[model samples]
Target: MATIGIVDTTFARFDMGSVALDEINKNASARTVRITVPGIKDLPVASKKLLEEQGCDIVIALGMPGSAEKDKMCANQASQGLIQAQLMTNKHIIEVFVHEDEAANEKELAQLMENRAREHAVNVVKLLYKPKKLIKEAGTGQRQGFEDVGPLGM
Candidate 1:
């Protein structure tokens, strides 16, 4: 079983992410994947706690183009911070980029996001690549201790 955490910048994005994740979880192979969507934030503290408290096996930071453009680096930065935090606590992390504007329809977008998440899960489980740690300890400025447990393979 995999406990998954999802964070997005807006309600629409969150809804989309939730729907997509839900679909993924419905699959027989993903039946054990529990997902939570804790909408976006400027800081990672709250979001981090939610995931940690849930004992998430993997955290997926979902971002859309519009939201990503707002801070220019919001998606990238948040993903990095959350990944670092989750890793420090020994959880896996995956950054999922959903191209909403480019999507032909809502269904398509949701499907795309679902596919992306599935792919990410697969990579993490396969130990193919480790996501970079993006946050630094408050005072130490040192790499926190966390294993890059690969994504949950589909």
Candidate 2:
């Protein structure tokens, strides 16, 4: 069976990793390895370890960037690190980042976190077993936390 790695941040207001795990369990028969770090900046190293040491085939790096400018800058730096890790490991690290400002209220924020995580979990299943499913979705504007914008008129 495939092993899926999940790296989440404690700084997040919601436990999106659990939501992803549930969705992954429902969609595929795979073993999941999860690690909880302190903040978004910690995600890259934790995720790299999951792939390099824990032998995960794919990893989901989940983080919630706060609504401050510094937080956004930190998120960008963390994202660069994640990309570097992926290149060094030659493995897929699916990024699932939700900005806290994306939602208007706490309730909406929680919902976005759950929705995004669950959607990306399904993507993981596809990447592992049915990659062509994603090919069919290309350019469809498939948003995770909210309604898809759909394809624009060409």
- Best by the lDDT measure: 2
For candidate 2, list the clashing residue pairs, or say none: none
Clashing pairs in 1: 8-40, 87-146, 121-151, 121-152, 122-153, 124-150, 124-151, 125-150, 125-151
**What is the C-alpha lDDT profile of model 2 across 1-154, one tens digit per residue?**
8999999999999998899999999999999999999999999999999999999999999999999999999999999999999999999999999999999999999999999999999999999999999999999999998999999998
Error of 1 at 41 (Å): 3.7
Models 1 onward score TM values of 0.51, 0.98
lDDT of 1 by residue, 1-154 (tens): 5555555555445354554466445542432233344443432554466466766555555555543466446556666776677677776555656655646777776666656655554444433223332222223332111223544456
lDDT of 2 at 122: 96
What candidate 2 gets wrong by more than 4 Å, as runs, is: none
lDDT of 2 at 55: 96
In every candidate, how many clashes are there? 9, 0
The 10 consecutive residues of candidate 1 with the worst lDDT sum are 137-146
